[model samples]
Target: MANPPLTPEDQERYQARLQALIVEHRDLDQVISHLAENPPPDQLLVPRLKKRKLQLRDQIWEVEALLMPDEPA
Candidate 1:
């Protein structure tokens, strides 16, 4: 079954969430890079940060897909 279209308010909320997730993902990338450069990086923390970043990326993709679904051929 087709999903119902999002209301204007829902669209706005989704956009806001998507932006926030993108920002968080970018921030995590910076932190991860910095940590890798610094001597004796916390092996545990680095992996956790990377995992979170991947989760955020997945969320961003989901929101984007909801906002603009692919058209059928």
Candidate 2:
């Protein structure tokens, strides 16, 4: 189902949240890379961190979709 239209204030909030998620996402990428380069990779921690990254990606997409204009038929 499509989300209801967001008010201007809501858009601002979402924009802020989106920026935060993007920053966190980038930071996670760096952390993951650093972890991978170490002598021994983390057998358990990497997967959990990856899962959180995936979740952030999904959230980013959702917020982007919300900001998109409706298609005209």
Candidate 3:
């Protein structure tokens, strides 16, 4: 089912949240890269970080869809 359209306040909130998620995702990418390069990275930590990054990406996509939903033809 289609979700109800967001009000102006809700849209603003979502935009803020999306921006924060994007920043966090970028930061995680940098950390993951650094960890991979620094010798003998913790096996457990890297995987966990990668997983979190994926989750963040999913969340960002969801918020974007909410903020800018597609129109029907």
Estimate every model's Cα lDDT from 0 to 1: 0.89, 0.88, 0.90
lDDT of 1: 0.89
Model 1 TM-score relative to the real fold? 0.87
Give the better candidate number (2 or 3) by TM-score: 3
Q: What CA root-mean-square deviation does each model show from the true structure?
A: 2.4, 2.2, 2.0
The candidate 2 region of ten consecutive residues with least summed lDDT is 38-47
lDDT of 1 by residue, 26-67 (tens): 999999898889834456998899999999999999899887
TM-score of each: 0.87, 0.84, 0.87
Candidate 3 shows a clash count of 0
Q: Write the per-residue lDDT of candidate 3 for residues 1-73, one digit (tens) a residue.
A: 5658889999999999999999999999999998888844457998899999999999999998888756773
Tens digit of per-residue lDDT, candidate 2, span 1-73: 6677889999999999999999999999998898888734558888888899999999999889987767653
List the candidate 3 regions with Cα displacement exceeding 4 Å. none
Clash pairs, model 3 backbone: none
**Ten contiguous residues with the weakest lDDT in model 3:** 34-43
Whole-model lDDT, candidate 2? 0.88
Per-residue lDDT value at 52 in model 2: 99
